[model samples]
Target: MSENWRLDPDRALPADAEIRKQARAIYDEIASLPLVSMHGHVDVDLFAANKPFRNPADLLIVPDHYLVRMLVSQGYTPAELGVPFTDNGGTVAGAEASDVETDSRVIWRRFCENWRLFRGTPTRYWLEHEFAEVFGLSAPPSAENADDLYDELTAALARPEFRPLALLDSMNVEILATTDSALAELDSHAELARTLGPDRIVPTFRPDSLLHVRHQSWAKEIAQLAEVSGIATDDYAGYIRALEQRRRAFVAAGARATDHGHVSADTTPLARTEAERIYTAALRGEATAAEADAFSAHMLFEMARMSTDDGLVMQLHPGVLRNHNARIHEKYGADKGFDIPTRVEFTRSLQPMLEEFGLSHDFRCIVFTTDETVYSRELAPLAGAYPSLRLGAPWWFLDSPEQMRRFRESAIETAGFYNTSGFVDDTRAFASIPARHDLARRIDAGYLGKLVAEGRLGPDEACETAIDLTYNLPRHAYARHERNA
Candidate 1:
């Protein structure tokens, strides 16, 4: 048997023996709770189609950027990683050439050979966890058992328990909210809501098109919005009405919040005259670069106002330098894990929107950042002071265990637990949701144990906090509280 290298409870413990035991116990208490995935990109079609997943490669390697990116960084071309060459064929193109090896044995051999590349990473941990927990694989994957394990996993996947909905049930997911664009029909979400009930499957509103002035699809996106809302997209007033119309449709489709992924958090609330002039230029597709930015900023402020009135929570994730690699972007398109972090200034950038809506009880805004420097300096303080503001959990590049711990330590001091919205698994890999949540829970419990050992919080309070952090906080954070409250 290849020796298994699983992380034990004591792996992250402090040097002190007594303190380590207490931390281990606390971590175990909440580690098995049902996962709450508040944000993610798992295709709703997975459930709506109700089709069995075809093979191990398609399910495990293709849809995940983490797996593909890591492999790419190790000098494996994306095509070799089974990420589509064409957007649709991207995932399966490599698999065809790979299939010429014909035997599942060959496929497993290749994967086993590359196993060492993932050591000591969260992806490794999650992959191992899934293999053991989901597929009953105890022997570590290597050359010897590669064919055996592949055949075994392939058989297991053919079982009904491996169905997407069945996997959700097995993971004990209370809810799974898929992010959908404003222009999307949400038919899949609707189908799942009907079959699984509205409470189990919900849609998150992601209106990224509204923030893009330079995208090729801007004019068409606006026209589509107008069509959805039965309004014209030619003028400023009509655009606002069209956006409003789309927001209502999203709500009807079971959205509780709107997600904005702007390059920065600059929420410039320009005057009506300025906005109208900018809008006119945008409609002509002749806006100056500065005018385009102004229009997007103005829309951010308007989005906040709409959130206040319509009761959809607002979430802003800023400072991603998207499409940083032009050639790669052209070939592979966006979200190939090429986006990098940039310095973010939330205090000044978000001031305009916060001034208008931050104090309103009706508005609920959760802000996310890739720039961790802003956690203590800007995000925590703003969320601490503003009634509507809540800091989103550590996200994207910062979702590691160390980063999660640092976030809680840095932000909890100023913003406290309540001011920070709870964990969101924010992943494209559906199976990793449970693993991600488990990692977060372990880290949070470890942090809470430190507080208890230091006498900052009593044991009972620490236990309660653990439960809230693991389960309750997410339910509350993503709930339609503004509508209900």
Candidate 2:
């Protein structure tokens, strides 16, 4: 065998010989399906500009919190990895004083030389796929190959075919949904749509900044929302109206879904007077943390109500303890990969919203969490009973091969396959999109293969399930058909 690192054709398939063969067959049938990435954080400006990637480090390492977090755990700092200074030249609290590495080559070298540290991680898997399949690398990165590989990647990125827009086609993405602020003008989305056609590069309305009332950016975001929507937000009613107007703007911009990320899944509704009181207090900078949380939960209910009226598929990803490391957060800004997962109780937390709109035909919500404990206990049962609820794919910390299989095993028996939203690669890394999707599909195929081999499912039925999991289910869950209309 050659010494060069190469991906096995059946890399993620079943390990048992007979089961492996069946899995390979299943994977083969669905491997080339066009990707439907319904929820992602890729910057829309990439497609709008169609610019050559800045460098290998910027494209692969700097933007990916997954990559950043692991390297940080091993004692490397974000600044050392070429992460830019966002807060006053990295002079914030707990900021490391080491010179921020500005050379992309040095940052890339640090990453490539330390490749062994990524073993048994999904980051490693995605990087391997990106290097081998996407970039056509013949060997895995190591200290010896660091400089050569950096030069190779730099050259490859300079090619016209390697630009972001062209790479989207190369990845065979049928449609992409970008997570955007509720207050955004979506100028980049408008420009990309003009060239790529509508619904191909669509916006996903994300209004997290508006609901976290006590955040430093809240008052500013509200003002920006007022300016963008042309609706004054001097009062609670005006604030609601401005948010509604923003949602409408997103729908007009070809959004089929709206994404909500909260620390808890609480959807408890408050009395209008109570909500008004909270909003007024928040505006006056007098609201307590508990009050802010109550308002956030209440607005989730409000958002669901709005979704019912406008038909934007609602996506809730809850239970993240954002900014666990206050020091890194202060210096690096948000999404520098210090977020931690917490145990989430969805049954009581979601009861109020479910009681109101769970059976409605017009409302559809796909709930996601990194909390695996709720998959079988709370989320699956809730989704099984509520027509409007669907279990989102295992995401963030739980989207690995083992965890994906665990998710299928845990949720499918109760909620069944149809009640689940198909895989959505919730990522900011542009190159990892296809790699993540492929891993999910392969894991699914392996799961289906086991069922067929056990005689629980026929081969034809398994194939159909594979195809649905790969393409069809995502379209239905994300309201893709309605995207253009």
Q: Residue 13 lDDT in model 2? A: 88
Candidate 2, residue 287: CA error in Å?
A: 0.6
How many clashing residue pairs, candidate 2? Answer: 0
Listed in order, each prediction's TM-score against the native is 0.93, 0.97
Give one digit per residue, the lDDT tens place, for model 1 in 190-309: 788888988787888888876666676888888888877789988988888888888888888878888888887889888899888888887888888888777777888889999988
The global C-alpha lDDT for each of the candidates, from Candidate 1 onward, is 0.80, 0.91
lDDT of 1 at 26: 85
Worst 10 residues of 2 by lDDT: 89-98
lDDT for 318 (candidate 1): 84
Clashes of each: 4, 0
Query: Judged by lDDT, which candidate is best?
Result: 2
Candidate 2 regions exceeding 4 Å error are 1-5, 88-90, 93-98, 480-484
Residue pairs clashing in model 2 are none
